[model samples]
Target: MSGPFDGLKVLELGRFIAVPVCGQLLAEGGADVIKVEDLDGDQTRHNGPIMPFEGRQYFNKNRGKRSISVRITEPEVLAAIQKLAAAADIVLANFRPGMSESLGLDYESVRAMNPRVIYGENTAYGLEGPMAPLAGMDMALQALTGLAHMTETGPEPLVNPIIDYAAAMLMAWGVSTALYHRERTGHGQRLNVALMHAAMFLENNQLTHVELLDSWRGEFVRYLKHAFADGKTWADVIEHRETLLPHKVVRAYYGFHATKDGTVGVACNARTQRLKLMSLLGIDDRWTSEPGWMPEDAHAHADYVYRQVATAFAQQPTAHWIAALEERGLPIAPVRHSDQLFFDEQVKANNFLAEVEHEVLGPIKVVAPPLRMTETPLAPRPPVSLGKNTREILAEAGLGAGQIDGLFARGAVREVHETLEDLL
Candidate 1:
C-alpha cells in the first residue's frame, strides 16, 4: 500500500529543523521530497557523529528523502533550482525574512513561475514585524514567549527543539491542507509559520491570561507551603489571593507516585476509580467537594489526603501497583526511561517503531509515523546519503550529461561518491 501523498513532489531549500522536518514528514507520507543543499551540504551533516561511522542524529530527522548539492550563488545553479521548483508541487524554505526574496526563492517569484506551487516558508520571528529580520532560534523565542519563565530548567531552552518541531508540524499540516485545496480548486498559495508563533501556541493557556494566571499560580504555591510546611499560614496570605481561586485547586487522587521500587502514574479521576483506589489502599474515603469549604481549609484537606495516598503507594513496588491497578481498570503505568520505549510491549505490538537497514549505518530503528490510515499506510524508506540524488535530480530537471559534468567541474554542483566514505 502507498500513502495519500504518493505522487506528490517537493523541493526543499532548508537547513536545521523547521523546514527540513516538514519535508521529512511529507516524505514519510509518500511524497517524493528532494532536498536542495548548498555545495558544502546542510549544517546538520556535522551536527552529531559523522556519517558511516555508526552514530548519526541526522538520520532521525532527514529520513525518506533524497538530496542534491548546488551552489546557490551560481547562475546555473539558481536556474537549475528554479526549474526544479517549477516542477515541484511544494517548496519549503526556512530563510531569514527577506533572504528568500534576495535568493529569488520567495513566494511571489516562485508563484509567478508556477501558480499551483505550494510555497511553505518558516521564519525566526514571522513575515512582518520589527523582529522579522533579526535572527532567532529555539531558546531566544522560548524566553520571549514566557516558556522559560514558566519552566524550572531556567532560561536554557528545552532539551529538545520543541518549538522548531512544532513549527515544522504546522508547516506540514498547512502543506497537506493546501494539497487538498488544490485538488479541487487548482490553486496554491504561500504558507508561513514562525518559531515564536509555535512557542506561543505551546504556551496558549499560560499566555492567554498572563496577570490573572500569575496570581493564581502564586496563590497555589503559597497554599502548598502553608499546607505542607510551618513556614507560612493561610490566613497571612489570604489578602493577596482571590477567594474563588480556591475552587480551581484540582488536586487529584490520580497522579504520579514513588513506589517502593520505582515510579508509577495513575489516573483515578472518576468517582468510582477514586473509590476503588481508596478500597485498594485500605484508606477511608475522606475527600469532599464541599461547595463552601474555605480556600485555606480545602488546601489543608487536599494535602492531608494526598499524604495518605502517597504513603499507601510507597508500600508496594511499581510492578505490583501496576498489576493491582490494571486489574481494577484504574488506568496506571510505571514511569519508564525513553530508551525503554524501544522494547515496550505495546509500542512494539503497535509497530510505532520501524526497523530499517541503512547502506551506511546498517540495521536501525526509527519512530514510524504516528498517523494511521488503513487504506494509505506509510512505508518510508531509510534516509538517503547526502547528495545521493544529485545526478538523478539534475537529469530529471532536463540537464544533459555534458552540462551536468560541466556544472560539477566548475564547482557549481556536486555528486555523491560512495567511495568518499573513507574520507570521513
Candidate 2:
C-alpha cells in the first residue's frame, strides 16, 4: 500500500536511542530512511539481551531502514554523505558538540549542498550551553533535571534510563512537526533537541506545581515531617495506606482489593468514575458529602472508601472484577506483562503489531505506528544490517564504483555480516 512519506528520503547519522528512534518513526511512516553508521557500526548494534542470534536493541529501533557504514572524516566518505544529504529531504544526527563539524556533517555544510534539507540534531544538552560539552545521557539528564530527586522513595535516588526513550519520542514528534512546516514553506530549518530540555519538559508538571503553589514547599515539609513523626520510611509514607490524599488513598485501597488471581490498574480520576466504583462495590454513605470531615483527614476518608472497594474486588479473580468494573463503567484494566501485551485482544484487534521478514533473522515482530490516520497508514519493513547498503546508497548519491571502492580501501567504508558473526 502507498504510504504517506513514500517519496521522502531521510539520511540518519545517529547512534543509540534518540535520533535512530526518530529515524525509525519516520521510516515507519514510509520515509526512505538510510541509517549512516561508522565503520564499526552503531554501538547499539552490540547492545543486548540478544534474541538467540540477532541484536535485539538494534532490530528494535532500526526497523524499516537501510544502513550505510561510512567514516564521515574521510574525504570520499564525506563527499558520498554530502551527496546523500543532497538527495535527502531530512538529515538527522546525534553527535556531540564539534563532532559533526569536525566530520564535515554539520547542518550548514549539508544545507550548502541541500538547502531544502530538514537538518535535525539530538544532543545531551543544547547546541550551545554550559553543559553542552559535558557527556550526558538519559540517566545523567534525569539526575541533573531533578527527576531522580522527585522519584526517590528512599535516601538514595534511583534513575531510570527510560527517560531517554520518552525524550526520543518527543524528539520524533518535534522533527515530524518541523518536516510538516518544511513541506509547506519549502524552507528546511535546523531542528535541535536536547536530552536536558526533554527531561525538564517531561517533569513540567512537578516543576509547574513548585512554581505555582506558594504552599507547596510547606506541604512537602509537612509530608516529610509526618513521615518522620509517624516513624515510617519514605516508602511507608508514600504507600497507598499512608498517602493521606483522597485519590492515592483510594487508589491504593482499590489496588489491593481489586485483585484476586492477578492485579488490576484502576483509574478513577473523575468524580463520576469514583461514584460508579463505589456503587459497584455496593457502598453508599454520607461520609462523601459530610462537611467538617477534617480537611486534613479527607485523604484518610478516601483511603477508607478504597479499602471497602478493594475488599469487594479481592473477593473475585481479576477477570471477575474486570467484568464487574466494566459493567459499572469504571476505568480498570488487568496488569499485563510485556509478552502478554502482544497477544492482548485489543492490540490484536487494532493490528498494533506487524510481522516483517528479515533477511537473516527470518520473521520478526515490530510495533505498528501508534498513530491512526484514515488517509496515511504506516507499513513495516525489515531493519538493515550495519553498512549493508553503504555502496548502494553511495551509488544512488551518484558516486561511481571506483570512487566507492577507494573509500572502502581507505578504511572509510566497510560492511559485515548481518548476524555480526564476522565481527564477533
Candidate 3:
C-alpha cells in the first residue's frame, strides 16, 4: 500500500496558507490531492511585483499536490471542476465565505453528485455569526481571540502566522477523524474550521485563570514584555507551573538565555534540578544565604535567582553550557534557528526530510511527514506545475481528447509555461 490514504482522492480549491496546508498534509499522508486554481494561479504565487523576489511562494504549502489552472469564472471550467469534485472523496475549499456558492462549487452542489464526499471549508470566523460575512486571516484572528491582549500588554498581534498553521493542523485532523467516522457509519459530514477558533484553542493553557495576573509585579513584570530581547514569550516564563503556584509565590524561572556564543533553554524548576543546576554553574547555595533556597517573595526571589543564573550563563557559550548541563539530565538545549534543521544530524538520521526533483528548480529538499506508520509504507506526493495534470484529470473525468482540446482553445483550461519575461 502506498499509504493509509492511498486510494483516497481530494479536490482542493485553496489559496494562501490554511486550506493549502490541509491539502499538503493529506498529500504527504499518501492521498492524491488536486489543487485547483484560477488561470493566473494561486494568489500566493505572486508574492510581490518583483519577479525575482516572487519565488514560487506556493512551493511550501502546495508541495506534494497536483495543480490545475482553469479560468474559474468560465462556466466550462467551473463545470469541469464540479465534475472533478463529484468524483473526489474529499473537497477542501477556502473561498471567501459565499464565493463558492456563487461559483456553484459549494458543499451542497458537490455533495449532490457524491453523497459520500467529505466537504470541508475554511473561513476567517465561522458560520452563523455577525462576523461570518466578513473576511479574516491569521493576524485578524490573533486580535479577535485574546492572543494579542494576553500575549502582549497592549493589543498587538503575533508576528508569526501561527493561527493559519494551527487551523491547517486542526483541519487535517478533522478530515482524518471524519473519514474514520464515515468508515464505520457509512456517511460523510461537513467540517468547518475557523482561524479565530484555531487561535483560541492554541491559547487553551495560557488563557486559563488569566484573572490572577492583576496582582503580579516586579520580576513577574518581565512576562509583560512580549519582546524579551532573546525572543522568549511570556508563556515560556510560566510554562507548566501556571496553576501550581499562587500569583504571590510564582515567578519566572525556566526559560531560554542568551549565552556568549548563542542561546540555551534551561529547565530547572524543581528543587533538586535547581541544586543540580547551581552545582554545575559552580554557584553555591550560600550565595543567597539560603542553603535550601525557596523564594518566599516571588518578585525579589525571581530577580535574585535570574540575575545570578543569567549572568553565569552569559559568561559561557551555548556549547559550554550544553556540555556541562545536558548529560547531567538538567534538561538544557541550545536555541537554534529553523534553517539549522537542514544540517541537524538527529533530524537527518530520523529521515525527517526528503529530496524531490523539480523540472525547473532541480532537486530540492522537503520536510517529510513527521509520522511513521509501522504497518503501512507511504510515499509522499511531489509538487507539480500549474495545470500540469489537466489533460490526465479531464481524461479521468471521461472527457475525450477533442473536448479537452476545445476547452483549451476556448481559454477554459491552461497549462503553466515559463516565458523569458518570467525569468527576468
Among all candidates shown, the one with the greatest lDDT: 1
- Number of colliding residue pairs in model 2: 1
Model 1 regions lying over 4 Å from their true place: 52-55, 148-157, 205-248, 251-255, 268-279, 282-294, 297-302, 419-424
> Which tens-of-lDDT digit does each residue in 1-424 have in candidate 3?
5677877999999989999988988887788898887777787777533242124557667887887777788766677788889989999999986899998889888888888999989999888889999999887777667587443233566676989988998999999999999999988889999888888899896555445554443345555454367676557654423433553322223888889998888887776777788777766444233645555555565666677778898998888888888778888888888889999999889888888776555676877775788866545555666788888887877778998899899988878764446655
**Candidate 2, 1-424: lDDT as tens digits:** 6777888999998888988888888898889999988777787777774532247788878889988887777777777777888878889998877888887789998888888888888888887868778768877776677677532365444434666677678877877787789879988889888888888787876565434434445565577656777777756645633343333324542343447788788887566676676666787534543423444565656667666766777778998878887887777888877889777888899888888987766787878777777878877788866778888888998889998888888788887665534324
Model 3: residues >4 Å from true position, as ranges? 48-54, 146-159, 210-252, 269-272, 282-297, 418-424
For candidate 1, lDDT tens digit of each residue in 145-240?
Answer: 757643222334577788998999999999989988998999999999989999989988655545744557765665755653654443544433
RMSD values, in order shown: 5.4, 4.5, 6.1
Could you tell me which 10 consecutive residues in candidate 2 have the lowest summed lDDT?
A: 240-249
The estimated TM-scores of all candidates read 0.84, 0.83, 0.82
lDDT of 1: 0.79
For model 2, how big is the CA root-mean-square deviation? 4.5
What TM-score, to 2 decimals, does candidate 1 have?
Answer: 0.84
**Against the correct fold, how does model 2 do in TM-score?**
0.83
